[model samples]
Structures are given as structure tokens and as C-alpha cells.
Target: MSKIVLARVDSRLIHGQVVTKWLQQSAANEIIVVSDELEQDEFLQSIYLMAAPPGVEVIIKGTESVKAYWENEAAAKNSKVLFLVPDLTTLREMVEAGVVKEAIQVGGLGGGPSRKNVVKNINLSEDDVEILEGLLAKNMEVYFQAIPEETPVPIHKLIEKYKTL
Candidate 1:
């Protein structure tokens, strides 16, 4: 089976930090982005492909299809994969599907009316917190670590900080 090097929840799926920091840090050769929206948009998919580094392969798939992709023998035997999902809901779905077995790294969620800043470059809404808390309850390691060099902040601590706000 293919080893999942990192499963990251970053709203900006494939970007500078991911390409320059996380990819290099994790030594991931393939980036698998799971997003239903992106799967239907060839333009955006092309853009994401163009953004990735020369040697790294980028595959965009919908949430439902990821389970099958995960089970594919060719994918499993090929290379280390860095899985990226846009939000907590997608992460929850993947985890529930048995696709993500490792610790989940929270990169960035961005700011919104219902969302609160948990750490620098990281934000979460009430729904996001609930999903993450559910994952934590299931004994999954979910933490915030934007880049490779920074220490990971536990999800509960961020929730506690969010509650105080």
C-alpha cells in the first residue's frame, strides 16, 4: 500500500508553503488533492498542476473516488503521497472512509464570519471545531502546524482558545 506521508487540511491546497516547505519536509513525491469542486473544474485543475514542482505529480480527485484511489495497487506501490483537503469536513470524510491513518496537520482555514483565528494563518468555524473534536475523540491526532519547522499545536488547545473568544 502507498504510504501517506502527510494528510494536511489547507484551504489553499497547493501553494508556496506546501510546495516549498511541506513537500520538501515530508519528502512527498506525489500530491493528491481531494476536492469535489476541483474535480469538476478542469481549468482550476490545470492551474494546480502547473503550480506543482516538475518532479512532483499532482492528482485531483473527488471525495467519493478517493477511497478507490487509495485502494489502487498502482498508486500504493508508486510513491509517497501528500494528501490535501480543503476543509475539516473533507478530512472527516476521508478519515471516516479509512483513507487517512496518520496524524492530520492543519495548515490554513482562512477567516470568515463564523470562523475564529486559532493560530497565525489558521482559522476554524464552529462546524470545523466539532468535526476536529470528533476526530480527536476517535483517538486521531489532529494539530495545527502551518509549516514543517513550527511546533504542532494540539487541536484541543486551539478549541480552548476559540471558546474563550
Candidate 2:
């Protein structure tokens, strides 16, 4: 069985921070990106797949496909893998599917209408707050931590600040 070293939500999925910082910090040898949209675009998939460091495997799959991959132990021989998703919606789907059930890292989200800058690099809209609150209700450990060096802001604190905005 594959162990999820970390599950992160970052809009810029395979950026510098993720490739250099989080990957080494988590000691994850494989990066499994779950995105329904990316699976349909081979060009984008190729870009992300090649972003990982040498020897670090990168597999792109959709929400449903990832679940199937998770179930099939033989699909990936690597033990520790990092799961990266683009947004809260996809994270919610993975969590509901029983694929991700532990700590969730909110890394980075770009600014948009109604999107409040909750943390250094993380921005959350009203819908994002609602989703985070729901996840918290389910006893999930969701937090905003851009990199491993910084202290992670808990979901409760993040939601409180979002409400104030």
C-alpha cells in the first residue's frame, strides 16, 4: 500500500515551492496530482509530469482515476507519495472518496474576486471558507502552510479570519 506523505492544495500545482521545498520537506519520492481538468490535456499533463526532480515520479490522474490507482497497490511501487490537488473542490472530492483522510496543506491560491488573502500565499473566497469549515466539522486537519519552515495556521483560525474579511 502507498502512504500519502502529504496532501496539498495549490493552484500552481508544480511550481518552484512544491518542487524544491515541499518535496524535500515531505521526503516524498512520488508526486500524484489529481485533477480532472489536467487529465484531459496531454500538453499540460506532460508539463507537470516533467516538473518533478529526477527519480521522483509524477503521476497525473483525475478524481475517480486516482481512487482506482490508490486501490491498486501494484500501480505504484513507491511507498511514500505526495498528493497534490488544484483547489478545495478537488480536495473535498478526494477526501469524500476515502483517498485523502488526514492532514491537508493549503499552499497557495491566486487572488480573485471575493478571494480574501487568508495567509501569506493562500487566498480563500466565501465558498472556500465554507468548504474548509465543512472539512473541519468532519475532523479533518486542514491548515495553511506555504512551506515546511513556517508554522501552519489551523483551519479554525483561517476561517475566523476569512469571516472577518
Candidate 3:
């Protein structure tokens, strides 16, 4: 069976850190980016395709199609995949749909109006916190770590620090 070596939620889907560090650390040869928005944009898809390392295969698919894609025999064999989703909501959807059941590495979430900084690179809104809490309740391992060399910060600790904000 194909292995989901790593599942990451990073707003910047494919970048230097992903290609140079995380991919090497996870030893993943395939990258499956789950994005509803990007799935329809061939231009953006091409950008991500070009950004990925030469040997790595990258496939962009909508959230709804992930389960079916994972069920494919070809997809399940001879592949070590690093799955990428943009946010916790997408991660939750994949987990609930049984497409992803592994631990998730939370990366850059980017700051916005209602969001608060949880770590150096991670920012979360109330809804993001709630989704993360729900994932924790489901026994999912969710943590934030910008790079492979850095120590991961547990989701609960960030929740405790930002719950009152």
C-alpha cells in the first residue's frame, strides 16, 4: 500500500522549505496537494508543478476527489506521498472522509484580521482553534513546526496560550 509519509497544512502549498527540507526528511517521492481552489486553476497548478523538485511527482486534486484518488490501486502502490492541505478545515475533511488518518504537521497559516499568532509562523482564528480541538478529541496528532529541525509545538499548548485572546 502507498504510505502517507507526512500530512502538512501550509498556506504556501509548495515552496523552498517543502522541496528542500520536509520532502527530504519525510523521504516522500510524491506530493498530493488537496485544494478546492487550486484544483480548478491550471495556471497555479503549473506553478506548483514547476516548483516541485525534479524527481518528485505532484498532483493537485480537489478535496472531494481525494478519497476516490486514494482508493485507486495505482495510487496505493509504490508511492510515498506527502499530502498538503491549506488549512485545518481541509485537514478535518480529509480525516473525516478517511482519506487521512495520520499525524499532521501544521506549518505557516499566515495572519489575518481575526487570527492570532500561535507560533512564529502559525496564526489561528477561533474557527481554526475549534477545528484543531475537534481533531485533538478525535486522537489526531497535530503540531506546529516550521521546519524538520525545529521542535514541534503541540496544538493544545497553542490553544491554551490563545484561547483567551
Candidate 4:
């Protein structure tokens, strides 16, 4: 079956690091971006479609679309699926909606007013940490890694280290 090879919450959606680092590392040929905005937004959809590698099929679908597609036989075939959400809330929604669970969760969260902690070059907030913890509590593997080479700090451990900050 086509398992979710990589699941990331990147505010930027599709960019260089994703095309080069995460996609290459995961060897994912298809990127299934689950975003309601992208589904209805032709401009955003075009941007992502052009940003992704030509060989890689980038399918932008709404949350409901994913839930339906994953249940189909075509999506069950052996394919590397990457789900890109803008934030943990969307991830939580996907899980709550009965969409397929990811084997691992990676955070590529970018800079924003909503997110600002500079945890080893990766910005984070207490709320973000709490969401990560919640996902971990649900038995999902969670970690913060900018790239594959950087030491992946466990979300739970990081929360303990910077909870007081």
C-alpha cells in the first residue's frame, strides 16, 4: 500500500528545502498537499505545481478529498505520499477526520508572528510545542529537524528543555 512516506507542517508549503532536502531524503515521487486553501486557490495551486520537480506529481486536494482518495484502490498502490500542512491544527484535523495516519511527523515550521522561538534556527512557540506533545501523546513519532543532517531533537524532550523559556 502507498504509505505516507513523509508528513511535514511547513508554512511555506512548497519550497527549496522541501524539493531538495525532504523530498530527496524521503525519495517521495508524489507530493499530496492536503490544504483547503490550495484546493480553492488557483494561484496558490499553480505556484506549488510549478515549484515541485517536473517528474514528481503534485496533487493539491482538500482535506475531504484526501479522505476520499486514500480510501480508493488507486491510492492504495505502492507510492510515496507526502502530506504538507501549514500547521499542527490542520494535521490534527486530518487525524480527526479519519484520513490515514502518518508513520512520522516532521516540523519544517517557518518564521511568522504566530511562530517565534528560534529553537536551533527553527522557530517555534509554546502552542506549537503543546500541539507536538499532543500528537506524541497520541503515539505519533514527532521531531524537529531542519534538514536530515541536523540532530533530530525529540519534540517531548525539546518541550522539557524550553518549557520555562
The runs of at least 3 residues in candidate 1 whose Cα sits more than 4 Å from the true structure, single-residue gaps closed, are 73-76
- Full ranking by TM-score: 3, 1, 2, 4
Query: For candidate 1, lDDT tens digit of each residue in 1-165?
Result: 678899999999999999999999999999999999999999999999999999998989999887888888425476889999999999999998888989999999989898888789878788988998899999999899987788889889999998898
Model 4 lDDT per residue over 1-70, tens place: 6777888877777888889888989989888888888899999799899999878888888887877877
Clashing residue pairs in candidate 3, if any? Answer: none
Model 2: CA > 4 A from native: 73-78
Give the clashing residue pairs of candidate 4, or none: none
Q: Which ten residues in a row have the lowest lDDT in candidate 4?
A: 98-107
**Candidate 3 — what's its lDDT?**
0.91
- Give the whole-model CA lDDT for all candidates, comma-separated: 0.90, 0.88, 0.91, 0.76
What lDDT score goes with residue 130 in model 1?
Answer: 92
For model 2, name the residue pairs that clash: none
Off by over 4 Å in 3: 73-75
Best prediction by lDDT? 3
After superposing candidate 4, which stretches have Cα over 4 Å from the reference? 73-76, 111-121
**TM-score on alpha carbons, each prediction:** 0.96, 0.94, 0.96, 0.85
Instruction: Note each model's CA RMSD in angstroms.
Output: 1.2, 1.4, 1.1, 2.2
Per-residue accuracy of model 3 over 47-72 as CA lDDT, tens digit each: 99999998999989998777788888
